[model samples]
Target: MATQAPVKTISPEEYLAQEELATERHEYIKGEVRLMSGGTPKHNDLSGNLFVAFKLALKKQPYKVYHVDQRLWIPSQQIFTYPDVMVASKPLVMQEGRKDTILNACLVAEVLSPSTKNYDRSEKFQYYRSISGFQEYLLIEQEQIFVEHYVKVEAKKWSLTEYTEIEDVIKLESIDCEIALADVYEDIEQ
Candidate 1:
């Protein structure tokens, strides 16, 4: 029988130093870092649509909507991630000495990819819950018109609402925004 070498974990500092120069982005958890996977066209479209929807709805509010380019830092979990769509309160708490990463995200949305749907639904969701004001989560399927919405109803508790039809609408209580399934699936094939 052959034995394989154990996986090595790098410190968060080392990961950030390398990320500064790398072309592709990476996610950091505790002391481990992993390169993030690329998204499909459908994934990109959904992310952009959701961002625009939230941005327009909260234009005059004290909230900011971030697209894929923004990084989120969960201090309690020691995790750094790039949410597909993040709606954070104004005066975003930035990681000390860093401007691109924010410390608070009231709502995080991810467009489900076949390779990452499971992680996004489980571990990733768990990480998001650790943030102080993190309250809503949206997992959107790229292969179908299905969405799983999780709302934080109480401390350590959450309620789920799923949407399947294109006419369905999600009223995000966390951020006080409404998004239609049709708008999210607009121009998206399959």
Candidate 2:
């Protein structure tokens, strides 16, 4: 019998570089790399609507908004994730001469998919809270009127609020802006 070749696990740096070189997006967690799935029609519509709303609200302000193409790096976890929408107040960090590591993001939003809902609501929410400069995290659901907002109160505490109606507005205290539930779900089929 022929001996099998040993498999190799790529380091975070290698994974990051490879992702940068590739045409498609890939997320790195610890030493594992996984290709990200494309968004559904509903997901895409929701994200586009939210992006427009956020852009309109934050225009002429100091904040900059980024959509899905951007990636955020969590050094603590050695992870790189692409938030559906992100608002950064300060300049982002660069790696491999690319500005992919977003720092000073005051608000991060994720349009929840069935596959990623639990992770986004629980694990990813916890990880985002670990960032010292992160002020708010938003999770929007597609199938229902579910919206979760996590606002950091201080170094050790955070407030949890959930909105499940189209009439509700998500108030982002850090940015002095409010997002209507209807605006977020606009154009989304469900």
Candidate 3:
């Protein structure tokens, strides 16, 4: 016979306290605190490349480009998560007491790793759509030259665009930025 303790959910307040002092990043969903695992080098490279591309493109603009560390708060879902890359032109709206958590995003991107690819394409995409200013979602594969781009066309409707060729240029509607897949996968292995 075996006995297991019931799982417990912590308040977002408690999670925030621990997150501030903890070395690792965590996602707060509803009332649960889930630790975020580290990504592979390939994943890191793609994220870095994407961030660099956005930074260079919006250098003089008023937009803010964020990499993995900046957290996003989805009020509708009561969740806190970090996107691989995010570009925002809307006015900055910080989570009530946090400078690192933002409430606005025009584009949110995720570097898809094997373990998270399915989730990122489904549940995570749904969560991202809840952002007030969110319009475009980018899902980039770390193991291949594939990107699934989604642009919101209407309420509850989004148009899908897929790119598989290295020469493909991803036009981000919300941010009015274009990035090449070759640049994103630069120096990274398949």
TM-score: which candidate is best?
1
Q: Between candidates 1 and 3, name the one with more favorable TM-score.
A: 1
Model 2: per-residue Cα lDDT over 123-145, one tens digit each: 88777776667899888888988
Poorest stretch of ten by lDDT in candidate 1 = 6-15
Query: What's the distance in Å from true for residue 97, model 3?
Result: 2.3
- The true-versus-predicted C-alpha distance at residue 175 of model 1, in Å, is 1.1
For all predictions, the C-alpha RMSD in Å is 1.0, 3.2, 1.5
Task: Estimate TM-scores for all models.
Answer: 0.96, 0.89, 0.95
Q: For residues 59-172, what per-residue lDDT tens digits would candidate 3 score against the true structure?
A: 888799999999888989989898999987747888897877898888989998777889899988989998878899999987789999999999999999999999999998
Instruction: Give the TM-score ranking, best first.
Output: 1, 3, 2
Root-mean-square deviation of Cα positions for candidate 2 versus the true structure, in angstroms = 3.2
* Candidate 2, residue 73: lDDT: 79
Q: Tell me, by lDDT, which candidate is best.
A: 1
Pairs clashing within candidate 1: none
| Candidate 2 ranges with C-alpha deviation above 4 Å | 1-8, 93-97
Model 3 has an lDDT value of 0.89
